[model samples]
Target: MNPKISDSIPQEDKDFDKQHIWHPYSSMSKPLPCYHVKSASGVRLYLDSGQSLIDGMSSWWCAIHGYNHQELNDALVKQVNLMSHVMFGGITHDPAIQLCRHLVELTNPKLECVFLCDSGSVSVEVALKQAIQYWDSKRQPEKKKFLSIKRGYHGDTFGAMFVSDPENSMHSIYTSYGPDNIFAEAPQIGFDDEWNEADIEDFKRKIEKHHKIIAAVILEPILQGAGGMRMYNPQYLKRVRELCDKYDVLLVLDEIATGFGRTGKLFAQEHANICPDIMCVGKAITGGYLTLAAVISTRSVANVISGGRTGCFMHGPTFMGNPAACAVSVKNLEILRTGAWKSQVDTIEKILLKKFKPLMESGHRKIRQIRVLGAVGVIEMKNPIDVALYQRRFVELGVWVRPFGKLLYIMPPYIISEDDLNHLVYSLISVATDESLA
Candidate 1:
């Protein structure tokens, strides 16, 4: 390593980044402060400032086994030496084949076909396209629009953005150009709230009224990320599955954020015990080693698309099945099969609830609600937080937690130690509870 570079990324480097790089939702006129992470291992991010922060966001909820994992690194390196990438046009490889095979077994075994993508958004685009094409194959081209819940976030692509909560999401500005997908009222029933049949009323109404035009009922399953880190009743999803089946609308489950044991189950759809016609899994699929996502579907869906009027699904990425990413993901699945995440997520949830109880019991005025499920813990504020201010505060206190909108949340890696977990939870709660910051 360059001694000068290792000492720090340099003030000029930070200055150059601020001038040139336009980060998510940041403007060039007044950009958000960006930190330089020297390296990462396990649950800590060693920064250029000679300070290490316990990562609470899991590098945006993908590093389930933490960072700089030896197994994942070796897998990626081994595949890279053999061959980094190759055109998937009329070729196949073991890594891609093995990864897809593992994904099918790990998820719903019946979801046999896998469509690899560059990111979560692309996976969603594939899912949306599949639904429309499936209907077209059946000679129902009119069934194009999707039915999605409010406060739901799918992804940032045009197709993904349209299906997300248009009015309340980060992509609202571009909603005018997006497809006019149906948006039912967001689920009013909380994750732990009493499961009233009324909670699913609006969704059911929309499905019934628009069954003819709706191609699919696409949702985030039991847990919704990004738009709002809200969890809903599993029964709501079960009922949604039933309605989709009854109305002849395909069901697409976007398990991007909640897949790979994030929700205590391997997949969030398992909570409802219902298999959708198409499913999107990403984020943690490669254990944060590389960018990869998959749109897995049933044989019926895949066959219909291939034998459709247009022919062969009509879409594919240049890096469709990159060997290195596939090898890393295959290893990631093998490690997950070891079942270590089960206990880690179990303990993390238990400890979060235990530590967060004091805040709930205190009845803090600023706190809107407190929710925990699996490895995710959220403390919703009554008002939106000063993101930049709170972010610096968190760094100063030696933790990395990125809060958005009204949600101050943590989705830490499953392998985080008890001490690191407490440190992160305590540091976050302290900032949340502190009157000076609030």
Candidate 2:
């Protein structure tokens, strides 16, 4: 057992949380019941109620190695004994250097430069700035707009929001407050569907028409999260890369959700065998241990931005390269490099396909579609679901599965055992088959 940080918060503290704390787009006035977790280990969450539930969300798809991992804990402890955080403005540390080197080696060769940020959104914001500054350096300041697909999700920050699928994105209400970036229709073909020329043509025309004003073409690549758990063909990615090169527009792939073997590759862009000018990665970077994201770019983009009108990147978070986070991230990459994560994800995909087959063949009218990729399994419903209701039901069934809009999905920790995974499947089936849930 780990040493205690402090005495545990009593029930009164939770009541106060209900009264005051805002929980991620939830209504405080009619707040949903917040489950108080006491501790977590492996793939299970131990609640204050003394009950443990299998974690199916992976803490929103970040905790790849699961909770309370000894290796990650040791890494953090060692880094804490040395130092935690230091300013990255003019100073650097071994943790930061080693982490950056690991990231560069993991990605495409041209993507050699890394800009560490505090979160996924900030990394994307940095990517946007890099693309814009790259164009500004090339003497085309008006090439400032970003073009993205209709169902893509980058992040919630203003710049990231501008490049996301505004209409379907949760930040849609703030559309009037942010820049109106262009949106091309999402590819019609599924990941497993036949390659369609029409899909490429639709996106090609949009890029060709707006190439002059578009500084970059940003996409989630392969899998789209948040907006929808949508998957598309890698061929589209290849074509998009070609179009970007043809128009001299930079390509920015936001792999915050798809990176780090989540989509059966260390980077989802690898599926297409093409490289982006800038790539944003986060989530599993630290094995869900700490907050750390990065914006990796090619040497050309870095050089152009350095010599640009701005004369610098013009952005740096105070905790840009937190040593503790970098140290944990390096350890996380080391764990992944063992090649076990690939086999684990492949096993997850196969199991999800087998377990979800009944639902796929159920012929239920309420079911819209079902899809699985890598470790992600999604059940899209025809009608919008009551998030609070479904979440409560999942918890009652001894699992944690957060349903958003019409999508009920699970991206469990890669270390999950078959028995635990089957239990998660049982909970999902219970939610889907229950007429009362509708």
Candidate number with greatest TM-score: 1
Runs in model 2 deviating more than 4 A are 1-11
1-438 per-residue lDDT for model 2 (tens digits):
221211355767867898989998789899876787889999999887676789999999899999999999999999999999989988999999999999999999999999999999999999998888898899999999998899888888888888888887787888999888888899873998889878977778888998999999999989999988999999989999999999989999999999999988888998899999999999999999999999999999999999987789989999999999999999999999999999999999999999989778875777888889999999888999999788888877889999988998999999999999999988887787788877
Task: Note the Cα lDDT for every prediction shown.
Answer: 0.90, 0.90
Query: What C-alpha lDDT, on a 0 to 100 scale, does residue 289 get in candidate 1?
Result: 87
lDDT of 1 by residue, 172-240 (tens): 889779688999987863777778998889999999999999999999978889878888889999999
Candidate 2: how large is its RMSD? Answer: 3.3
RMSD after CA superposition, every candidate: 2.6, 3.3
TM-score for each model: 0.97, 0.97
Positional deviation of 270 in candidate 1, in angstroms? 0.8
